[model samples]
Target: QAGTALLLLVAVVVAALPAPSLGWGVDGHLIICQIAQGRLSDAAAKAVNELLPSGAGGNLSSLCSWADRVRFRYHWSAPLHFIDVPDNVCSYSYDRDCKDEEGVKGRCVAGAINNYTSQLLTYGSSSLSPSSKSSDNLTEALLFLSHFMGDIHQPLHCGFASDRGGNTIDVHWYRRKTVLHHVWDVSIIQTAEKDYYDEGAGEFVDALNKNITGAWSDKVQEWEECAKNQTACPDKYGSESITAACDSAYKGVTEDSTLSDEYFGSRLPVVNLRLAQGGVRLAATLNRIFGQSKA
Candidate 1:
């Protein structure tokens, strides 16, 4: 009973403090989900609509950050939001980097993507209503999959373990003091929106949508393809993230580095590409999962 009380106290304290921005910041996740839902197949759109909570009103983007909000409540899920690779190693290995601190396998973002994708695949297969209450909590699975898709695309989410995905490396976003991880997760997107999109995330989404169908039309198919027709290709995404982390996210600077116009200018394009790819891949994964289901 004392232990339970202590745990509850800790939870209260943690909840009282401002939560660290994990995964992509709220807007980042929102942009990705918005882009994804717009590209969903007819069947996937229907399944997603049915699976979303009643309050969502068919807008998946509105709740794209739900997984992050539930971290304190779902303590075990905290690890599911990012991967930690060896410091100075510009690569990711599922067997090596996908474990939690206790060494449990399949606990990182990629594994979470695979797990939630599998869970959501059960939709429309049950004799009962696909959206009905179930042990797998398919609604939660849908939300998790949506959010993790965004997280796996943020390069620093796959950053070096020693720096805790750049969380430990102090940096400045223009003049404000922050961490490198936060810069990738939130600052870059926010700056892009402010500078070019009139501070509207919706406008940013519109620009990405234009690129998806316009400039990036040729690449979208390749981005969505999974080897051997796998339901989700998170391993590929993870690998891409680590490589981007090395080449772009962690390329320059050390502790106390100030990131300004030059840093933001170079990194914003990478951010845009990753966000676009995340949306396309998520829609592709969901389409594969629910495309054949009679909804």
Candidate 2:
């Protein structure tokens, strides 16, 4: 058909373009941050505002993907964005599992969270004099938290060592050449919510905010409790995602990489659950750090 031919042409054109800097994609990051903002405590909200740039309208969600934007500038930080776990290990031990390209231990997303959290607390204290460097550091920490929160929840980010987080396992999403990680990072969300693909950025975000369908409402408390504990550390997120990557992220791969409808349907719930969990945890983290009382 003529329509089908046109679509294939478009797909070819898109596939030729440069690949996006892989996070949860722009929409996924925005949705997570936006949801967190709504749940922020008054004290937490105030604290977050003090750290955000004035240009951002004191809105945390607006800067959700700032880390990825500054990735090339802060090249060393690229490794801190993800964890590489071997297949079926299904566990994260900061002492054993954390690593980066430079063979640095404790240099992945979980470590970044711990580091920024420490920096936030240190720079956040009333004892320290307010200086531009400290202020800048605090802002950077906030941005990292905003972005890393989204990254940790993406199953592929915690993927196996052999596949480079599914990057090496070649795949295609809807006839376009892509990798397994790319599918989760880009296509799954779009395929699942294709109706909103053409919608304006804000329109899609508004739709996500309005839709409250997921398992997060029940698990927010439990997840928050787990995150609040210091000993849980990497396992709180990394372990869970790696396990899921083994269970769900690689489900549709075959010789042709044609993802069937079943794969999309099954993963849609996962996409939603991960987003919800990331949003709730982001809010809970800020609440504990900046709320009326610390955990």
Candidate 3:
């Protein structure tokens, strides 16, 4: 009986763990699809095609693969000095409002670069080296970089001080004790499935592309503004405040409801827009490193 109870407890604990969240927008995938489809300068298209499997499939998974690899190769060096710091601290700006000094770091951009670089160095180096040009690890690193770059851009992935990037903050999403980060990661993907229903990869690609062009500027501006505003630091950008904002923004909506036109409605545009920007920036970064001009 005692062994059975322990097993059950272990199962419960495992079940309660949050899922991995990937900070991606629909537009990111859309831009990849557009680039794949459009007139690429032979070299750029060839590079993209090599990254993608069949030079098709513009789904989130495909795009994520591309982004992960790109980011892994470029930003791996920046994060080694900063990951141990709390998200709130990392996101905090002393210039804006200095409250608790315990967990607060500096600003999000620097933090993001730090966090991103750390993940890359840890994962990418073990997988590939920057000096080697002709190894499979290099390929893997590029893919990891591609996905991680997108991940860091996500405001939440930079993390929050209070809840460990929403790990601790518990809330009910349709009665389940879901954390803010997990909700953004899984629930949002589930929601995307329900709304803007796409049966085929082509349709999915089309949807992603259409939305990406529409929202890229706004997403970049949002990050840029946040970077510029001193007041956007610790006090306002803390984990608690971010958690509250996410809960308020995306609470009751479920997978089934999300599929409906009324689910996310127009708000969905932001996803693709961010994705597009990430992709463009990612490609640009890669070109610079690989001795290729930006496409």
lDDT (CA) for every model shown? Answer: 0.92, 0.76, 0.42
Q: How do all the candidates rank in terms of TM-score, highest first?
A: 1, 2, 3
Alpha-carbon RMSD of each model: 3.3, 7.4, 9.4
| Model 2 C-alpha lDDT per residue in residues 141-247, reported as the tens digit of each score | 98998789889999988977777788787766767887788788878877756654464446655555555434234555676665445522445788788878878
State in Å the error of residue 81, model 2.
0.9
- lDDT tens digits by residue: candidate 3, 1-295: 9999999999899668643333444334344434333423455444445555554452224555454333335554323111222433433343442222343544233344333333323322332556643334433444544554454434454454455455465655444566655554444444555555553434545555454456443553343233442311222223333343344333453323222344345434444444444444445434333323222
| lDDT computed for candidate 2 | 0.76
RMSD value for candidate 3:
9.4
Any runs in candidate 2 off by more than 4 Å, and if so which?
1-21, 126-136, 196-216, 231-234, 292-295
Cα displacement (angstroms), candidate 3, residue 219, comes to: 9.1
Model 3 quality (TM-score): 0.49
Candidate 2 Cα RMSD after full superposition onto the native fold (Å): 7.4
Per-residue lDDT of 210 in model 2: 51
Give the Cα error of residue 134 in candidate 3, in Å. 7.8
Candidates by lDDT, descending order: 1, 2, 3
Model 3, residue 50: C-alpha shift (Å): 5.2
Candidate 1 lowest-lDDT run of ten = 126-135
